[model samples]
Target: MKNEELRIKKSGFWLLASGFWLLASGFWLLASGFYILASGFWLLASGFWLLPPTFILHYPLLIIHC
Candidate 1:
């Protein structure tokens, strides 16, 4: 039905948004990891502080597998 189609569309939009957010967060983590690895203790400490909350926020979205 039309309502069902609308619901599906809405869900699709949400999925796409979630995917974008996850990708962004992943890139952030990767860049942070590399900075941590390449640089000395200060960069490593900063990267550690910054990356975890991003990972934690996106962990459930990553599990979505969509």
Candidate 2:
């Protein structure tokens, strides 16, 4: 009877550990996903900032060539 109780306790401990691991991993994934999304927005903003210099440099060159 004691052995049976010991097995039940062991299984319960493993179940709790696995549950905690899954929760931790899920939170980590969510945090990384948010970080990636934020970086993507930053990249888009940087691209916008870069556009005017490109237009200024190219348009006159095209007109001069033509």
Among these predictions, the greatest lDDT belongs to 2
| Position 44, candidate 2: lDDT | 86
**lDDT digits (tens) for residues 2-66 of candidate 1:** 99999999999999999999999999999999887778877767876878788867868999966
Measured with C-alpha atoms, the lDDT of residue 56 in candidate 1 is 68
lDDT digits (tens) for residues 1-66 of candidate 2? 999999999999999999999999999999999999999999988987878887867978999999
Task: Return the top candidate by TM-score.
Answer: 2
User: What are the lDDT figures for the candidates, one per model?
Assistant: 0.89, 0.94
Give the lDDT of residue 13 in candidate 2.
100
- Candidate 2 Cα deviation (angstroms), residue 15: 0.4
- Candidate 1 lDDT for residue 27: 100
